[model samples]
Target: MTITTTRPEPASADLGTDPQEPAGRRVLTGDRPTGPLHLGHYFGTLRNRVRLQRQGAELFVVVADYQVITDRDIADRLAEHSENLVIDYLATGLDPESATIFAHSAVPALNQLLLPFLSLVSVAELGRNPTVKDEIAHSRQSSVSGLMFTYPVHQAADILFCKADLVPVGQDQLPHLEVARTVARRFNERYGAGIFPRPRALLSEAPLLPGTDGGKMSKSRGNAIALAADEDETARLVRGARTDAERRISYDPAGRPGVAGLLQLAALCQDRTPGQLAEEIGNGGAAALKRTVTEAVNEHLRPIRARRAELAADRAHIRQVLRTGAERANAVADATLAEVRAAMGAVGSA
Candidate 1:
């Protein structure tokens, strides 16, 4: 995938005007909470989530706490990371009043749908999912856990539980969304009831953000600059970022990806395009390029970091926001589960 760093303006009216009501499609998207968010997440999904919410989409942002165990075994810091993820969401402009931000483990009814959902897709079909294949290939484990194997089905349940008709995902995630649509179709055909909506993938136009080393940005890679990083830290990382020996700066993603990535990052922090930024910084050398990138990144994230600090100070408030969101999610999930039970010829609690 190509690396792009252009931020789009939100085209909707003011948010929270009608907090209880949404004027657009239902959106479902989330993160694993493995670690703090970075610029990649900021440009990729976080910003888009806020934009969609502002556009009157009834957004459901799941933290996917349970999905953390699909690959790693570090549960000691899970709670801290999950709370931090919520803080990042808020800092990025996701209004809790308009967007439902909840964790997967907190929504029991949503997970319960997995039983029937699992039966709809065969093991062979599950094995064929490209997303799952990529995950397994990247995983450190020699053997796949059962949860890891059925991850795509679990994602299907996550989407169908809320009856989310639209899922914001990158191109790589389309196969996983397809599983949800398949499960919805098969369940409706087999049980003779449309209990779930076949969620559609709203593909993001923003390209991937490469790490400082010119690779896919990831927390585990240690190349990513966390959204919470201080200005000095951001500068240090950018200073050490890989760049070619050539002094002339140009946006040649194919030939000078490292320099180009920095240009893209700087452009994303403001309104200029990568090519325009490169032209403006002609012959400034890598030092000037890194300096420009550091300044832009820090300036862009300053207010967000300030908001994050305030939110982090009030730990109690953060937890309460999550609790309220979970309560709302449970109500929706329970209603869906009841409909699922009725369609499956099972009894719901009287």
Candidate 2:
């Protein structure tokens, strides 16, 4: 049997002030604390999260520790990785006072919300999720974990537990958010109560920078420039980045993905377009282009790296920030879970 899937409409137009949500909107966005964040993350969603927080939106940035174990065999590194993730969030200008940041595993209520949400979605439907399919393919594993297979259901609980009206995600992730919307709709329909909001995807305006190999920027790919990378390491990575044999510096992504990748990185750093930079560099050659891109990246990252170093030294303060964040998050999540249980007529819902 053929199972067809329809993609959600890109919510680009809905980003500007939603008249429906006059009291402002609550937003939920997160990163799996599998590794240190990189420039790809900064441009992809981190910057947008900060902007939304400053605009008075109730923002929740979850350090998704539970999601990290989907593929990782070494669970011991989660502690260090989770800490580093929060440090990167702070260093990247995410104000703890403005945004509620917490680890996913810290919220037991969120996990409890998962069972009902899972019942709302079918196994065949879950198998059809584009994001899950892509992730499984990317994992290069022969067998899939049950936790990984049901990730979209868990993600639904994550958003609904906060009653998030907005979910900041890339275009590629819109389908996953759509699954959450479907689950929310199904639950409300079955329970005859509007407890969960259908979270809309807030499409990011930032340009996605490709990896050094011109593929998706990923930590496993080893092409990403970590936000915690020191100046020397950053410089070394950029200098050793792959580029075409063609000496002329032009922005033809299809023909020269390697050079185009560098140009895209430079464009993002300088807040300019790749074509504009390519034209300006006109025949400056690949060597000159690499040098310019490398400097721009290092200069941009210098302050963030310094801040991360300082935060790393004061582990006590980092722990405090996370501890307080967890408390704040639990307060909200617990209340939501209570309402969900009451709606479903679960025992001890009172």
Candidate 3:
């Protein structure tokens, strides 16, 4: 009903340089359109992306709208959700002008690109992909759809079409990243060389930042702290975070996940380490620790949330950004598509 065609390719940020890293490298990275970004994204990659942009690197922040269909449960908020994500991104330091910001649903050509790309990859390779295995296991969907099963292909198409050289990914996502690299290599091997640049993975500074509940901070698990959440919401969520019965404050993630989770949040917010904060706490009680961490998180996210609200007001502006981004993204993708077709002999040959 919502024009469920193949998702458009996402926008990427990276310099248009040769694979030899001439000048600088181009980057393609983004979050799923399933929900708003969270602290995990912020500290894990968003912060790094902002730093890269400032350093005169070309970058693309894809909204990954096509990924939403792999788990198309959020039918009501498909378009609206993607638009909100754009707003959150703008409020953060992801300047649209500096980077292309396209959604999956908007660029149908990327999906068309997937046909040939998927052929280059083998079924065994897809089966061996750890991320796909994890998603299947986590979703518990006995009969997985082809879309869910072949997500790596979509990822390959996403990065390949954009010719992204750098894709910052978490360690857990290495398997998928590997798939993308493998596909890039395979394409070059099948056709001539230089079909697409093999994207490098930028592993997170602190991979898998634990949620307030001491579990992987994910939306499905209800443990994530949304980036656009207000000060009151952030405080309430922090207050509800899991902690240990021991009153004394100490930072031991393995031994005391709940309490350590608080410390991690505090440290990340204050730009300190959990152990350092633990030493500073000396012999503070758990209540004091939670209160302190909550306050710190509140302080850190207050400005971000406020800025998000201001940006959310003009949804039209966000749409314009995405629209403008698609034009720029397609300009690059179309040329690449033509090259790919010519290389594969698909252009003039019926």
Instruction: Quote each prediction's TM-score.
Output: 0.93, 0.93, 0.89
lDDT of 3 by residue, 1-350 (tens): 01112222222323223233422667888878777778887777777777677666688777887677675544457788788778777776888887889977677777778888788777776876778888878663457778888998898888878888777776677677777777777778778868787777765566568888899887778898898787778778887888877766777878998888778878998989898888877677776787788788888877877888888888888889999988888887778778878888885433
Residue-by-residue lDDT tens digits, candidate 2, 1-350: 22225555455533436445413778898888877789899888877776666666788888888987665544558889989988988998889886888988888998888888888888998898888998888764467888889988888888988898888888888778888888878889889999887887777877668987788898888999988888788778888888877777889988998889999999988888899889888788877887888888988878888898999999988888888889998999889888888998999695
lDDT (C-alpha, whole model) for all candidates:
0.86, 0.82, 0.76
Find the 10 residues in a row with the least total lDDT in model 1.
1-10
Poorest 10 consecutive residues of model 2 by lDDT?
Answer: 14-23
Model 2 accuracy (lDDT, Cα): 0.82
For residues 247-267, write the lDDT of model 1, one tens digit per residue: 999999999989989999999
Clash list (residue pairs), candidate 2: none
In model 2, which regions exceed 4 Å deviation? Answer: 1-9, 13-23, 140-142
The per-prediction tally of clashing pairs is 0, 0, 12
